[model samples]
Target: MGIYKILKTAILSLFFIVTVFSCKPKKAQNENLLLSKKNQLKKAFRYPNYLNKNYILGKFDYMNSNNFVIVPKDLSNKKIYIRKEVLVAFLKMQTAAKEDGISFKIISGTRSFAHQKRIWDYKWNSKYKDLPPLERVQKILLFSAMPTTSRHHWGTDIDLNNLTNSYFTKGKGLNEYNWLLKNASKFGFYQPYASKKEGRTGYEEEKWHWSYKPLSQLYLKYYNEHISIEDITGFDGSKYSKNLQIINKYVHGINSELK
Candidate 1:
C-alpha cells in the first residue's frame, strides 16, 4: 500500500470517475465551449400543460418518462420523446445541420391526450364521418391537432426533416428548409406553420413543424393563461371543443415571432 501510496490511491480513483462524467450533457462543448451537466439537465426540464380532462385522457399518454426526455440519439428509429430542453436545442440543431449538408430528422415528437385521442378518433370516426362538425373542424384543421389544443401537448414541439411540403422542395429538402431558415433562430427554433403565402390561419402550411422557442414560449403562455374550452374534453371529436375558435385560431397558430 506504499508505492507512492498505491499510485496515490489510483490517481484519486481516476479523478473520481472523470469528475463524475465531467459533469455530464454530451453532444459535447467542453471541447471548453462549456455547458454540460447533461446540457444543464437539458436546461432544466419542465413540460406541463396536460390541460386536464384527467390530465388529457388519463395521464398524458403514460406521461412520457414523466415530462419527456428519451432522445439520446435516435433521430427516428422510434422512442424520440423531446423536451429536455427540446433535446438540447435539437441536438444543437442536429449538429449544426450536419456541417451544411442538413440532415435533421425527428419524424414527430410529443403527442398525448391519449396520443391526441387516437389522432382524434382516427379522423373522427374513420376519416371525417362525412364532414360537417364545422366542416369536420375545418378538415381537421387541415392536418390535425384538436386533442386539447395540441402543440404536441407542449413538449416544445418538433416534427422536422420532412413530413411533407414536398419534402421541403427539391435538393436535400431545399437544403433543409434553407438550413432551417438561416440557422433555426440561433438554436431555439421556430416555424409553427408559417406561410399562408402570408396570411396564416388555424393550420395548413406546416413545413415540417418546429418550435422550442425558448420552451414553447412558456407553453404558449400557459395555454393562454390556464387552458379552457372546458379544459378540452375527452375524445371523439370532443364535441368540437366548445364550437372551436381553438384559443384564437389554433392556440395562436404561430410564426409571428412565436406569439
Candidate 2:
C-alpha cells in the first residue's frame, strides 16, 4: 500500500484500540478496589466530613445511604443498615445457611459515631462510673469501641445472632455460628475477635462479631496508619486514651487475622 494508506490504517488501528479500551469496564477505578496502601490511606482521609459519620475521631467510615441499603426486616428484625455490597453478600449467606437449616439475624449492624457514643456513655454513667477511669475504659473496650472507633462505623462489621459464647455453644446458636465459621468467608465475612490457640489481648473473644474483609481491610489500614489515641474523643474517659494507649492496645488490638 502507499504511504497514505499505511498511515490511514495505522490511525484506524490506534482509534480502534482506544475505543475498545475505553469501552471496557474500568477495573480498580470503577470497582473501587483499594489495593495500594498509600492510595488507600489517601482515599480514606479524603472523604469530606468523613469523620462526621463517626464523629470527628478517625473511628467512623463515611456514610452515604446511597452506599448503604436498608436490610429486610426479617433478616434484621430491627431497622439496620450495611454497606450495599455487604448487604448483597449477607443475603447470599442467609440463603446458603437456609439451605442447611440454619438461619441468621443481624443482632447489630451499622452504627454511627453518635450511636456508639450513646452506648459508651450509657455504660460509663450507669455501669462503670464507680470504677477507676482506666478500669472503666478497659471494661468498655473489652466489648465496645470508644465512641469514634467502633468497626460498626464501617457498616461492614456486624454483630450476629448472639454476643455470648455460651449462646454459640449449643442449639441453634451453635449451628448458626458453625455455619458462619464454615461459610461466612465465602460471602466475605470474618470473625474479628476469635482467640488464638495460645492467647490474645484487646477485646474479649466476641463470637458474634464478623467483618466484611474486603472493605474492612482498607478501613483497618486507615486506622493503623492514620488514627491515634489522641485523635479519639467526645466520650467519657477518652482523656485516658493516651494513658491507656488505646491506639495500639484497643483500636489496633483486634483479631490478628482481621488485620
Candidate 3:
C-alpha cells in the first residue's frame, strides 16, 4: 500500500506540472501574438485612425495628405486620389502592363463620403425615387455602394479602363482584362466583384473595379470587425441599411480571395 501511494502521488504531481507548464506557454504565446498583431497594425497603418471605420467610411480628408497621392494625369482621366502604397504597386504594375502592350487607365479612384453621398443622392432622387426606399437602394447597390459602405472610401480600390461589362468581353478591353487576370495578383490587385458564378457576394461583376488587396484586405478586416450597419447613417436611404444587410452582404461581401 505504501509503494502504491507513492507512485500515485508521483503521477499526480507530474500531471499537475505538465498541465501548468503547457497552459502557461499557450497563454503567453497567445498574448504575444496579439501584441505582435497590434504592433504590426500600428506600425504599418498608424493604428486606430487608419483602421477605424470612420476612415473606412471616408470621414478623413485625404487631399494634400501624405498618406494619399494624386493619380498622375497620365494614369487617370481626372484628378483622383489613391493610397500611397496602392499607387506604388499600381505604378509598378502599370509599367509592366505598358511593356506588355496592355494599357489601362484609372477611370475612378478614391471618393470621400461626401462624394459618394452625392452619387447616392443623385440616383436616389432620380427616377428610382418613386420606388420603395429598400428597392431604390437595391437598384443603386447593384452598381454603387451606399455612401459609408463603399470600398472606394478606403482609397485602395479603383475603376480601370471602362465601366461597362461588355467592354471587357472582347477586343482591347478583353485583352486588358485577360492581362489583369493573368498578372494583377503579381502586384496585389484583385477584382473584388467577380461574377456571381464565381460565388462572390456583393455588387455585380465589375470587370472595371480592382482593389489593392494588401492594404484593402486589412482595412476590410477592421471594417468587418468594428463597423455595423447601424453605424451607416446620414444618407437618404440610411434606414434601409440594416434591412439590406449592407454590412454583411455589401461591405463584407467581397471576393473570397480578398477575405
* Residue 98 in candidate 2, Cα distance off native in Å: 0.8
* TM-score ranking, high to low: 3, 2, 1
> Which digits, one per residue and each the tens of the lDDT, describe model 1 over residues 40-153?
786787555444444432345544456577765558756767768788778888888888867877877877667777877788777888987777767877878877777877
Write candidate 2's Cα lDDT for 90-207 as tens digits: 8899998889998888978888878889999988998898998788888888888887677887788888887788999898888888888899889899888786454665678888
lDDT of each: 0.74, 0.78, 0.89
On TM-score, the stronger of 1 and 3 is: 3
Model 1 / residue 256 / CA error / Å:
33
Query: Which has the better lDDT: candidate 2, or candidate 3?
Result: 3
Error of 3 at 49 (Å): 5.1
- The digit string of per-residue lDDT tens for model 3 on 147-194 reads 888889999999999999999999998999999999999999999998
Cα TM-score per model: 0.30, 0.75, 0.83
Candidate 2: 10-residue stretch with minimal lDDT: 47-56
